[model samples]
Target: MILWFTVVQVVVAVVAGVLGIVLGLAGRRPSDLSVGGLALLELLLIAQIVIAIIAPLAGNPPTGSLLEYWVYLVSAALIPPAAVVWALLERSRWSTVIMGVGALAVAVMVWRMQVIWTVQVA
Candidate 1:
């Protein structure tokens, strides 16, 4: 995985998470800005997925289990959309909170992916 790209992804996720939490605390539902942020995060994740697949073909395979890495990548890809859908359905401040939680989840998953990529074999 590319280090800078991963860093950007983490930053975006954290920002989105914080934004969501602030909005929720302000007793607002998911706004266009929040939804757009989530959409942007989703785009970044999709880019990461493409890069992950291409990197190995380009001879840059991850050091950890490929299956595990792929699983994380796939799950990370799903989060934003799922959160958005849930938020829309719920139509409350809690929807923003849910989005925040989802954003945090993506951050952690990305961090785990970084660890997986950098793991050293004995």
Candidate 2:
């Protein structure tokens, strides 16, 4: 994966996570700030998907197990929507925290995906 793009995703995810946790702890329910943050993060993941598709064709193909990289990428892309749905249904501070945790989880998963793409060998 592209290093700069991965860094952007990680940073966005971290910011989103921190925002959600801070808002939740401050007794805020799921609001635009929290939900919007995740939405933005998801958008970044989608961009990453597009990038991944094109990067290989551009002569930057991953050196790792393609199956593993794909699995991590796809799974990371799913987390935000799941967390948002959970927050909407539960409508509690804890749900907000869950979203935060989910964002953090995505961040970790994205990092792993990067490692798989750039470092791992098949």
Candidate 3:
């Protein structure tokens, strides 16, 4: 729901997506750097989840509709493991596709968070 968090996710996702394409073009499988980047993105998502939970606990937080945030958070959480699994199962260009999928997941999560935070009406 945070503006800056959405920005971060978008920037990271775009960078990751570009990297995915580049890796694929290079004809290499998912490299250590790609996995490391995914891990970093996953950590950021994990922190965001904790922050989303704690901020409301510390003070008042948006609560009219929690499902949107939950869905995005869950989707973001699943992406890393799913990507790792998919990348291993499908190598070369397909592995890059899996990486791109993870990046897209981040973008989707960012968009969902933005909408959830910006909506005024219940």
| Best candidate, TM-score | 2
Q: Write the per-residue lDDT of candidate 3 for residues 37-95, one digit (tens) a residue.
A: 77777887888888778877887476446776778788888887788678877767768
Q: CA RMSD for every model?
A: 1.1, 0.8, 1.9
* lDDT tens readout by residue for model 1, 1-122: 99899899999999999999899989999999888889999999999988987998998878888888889989999999999999999989999988988998999999889888777441
Off by over 4 Å in 2: none
Model 2 agreement with the true structure over 5-70: per-residue lDDT tens digits: 899999999999988898899888998889998999999999999998999999998989889888
Q: Rate the local accuracy (lDDT) of all candidates.
A: 0.91, 0.91, 0.75
Model 1 residue runs over 4 Å out of place are none
Selected candidate, larger lDDT, 1 vs 2:
2
TM-score per candidate, chains pooled: 0.96, 0.96, 0.85
* lDDT score of residue 3 within candidate 2: 92
Question: Judged by TM-score relative to the true structure, which candidate is superior, 1 or 3?
Answer: 1
Model 3 per-residue lDDT at 7:
84
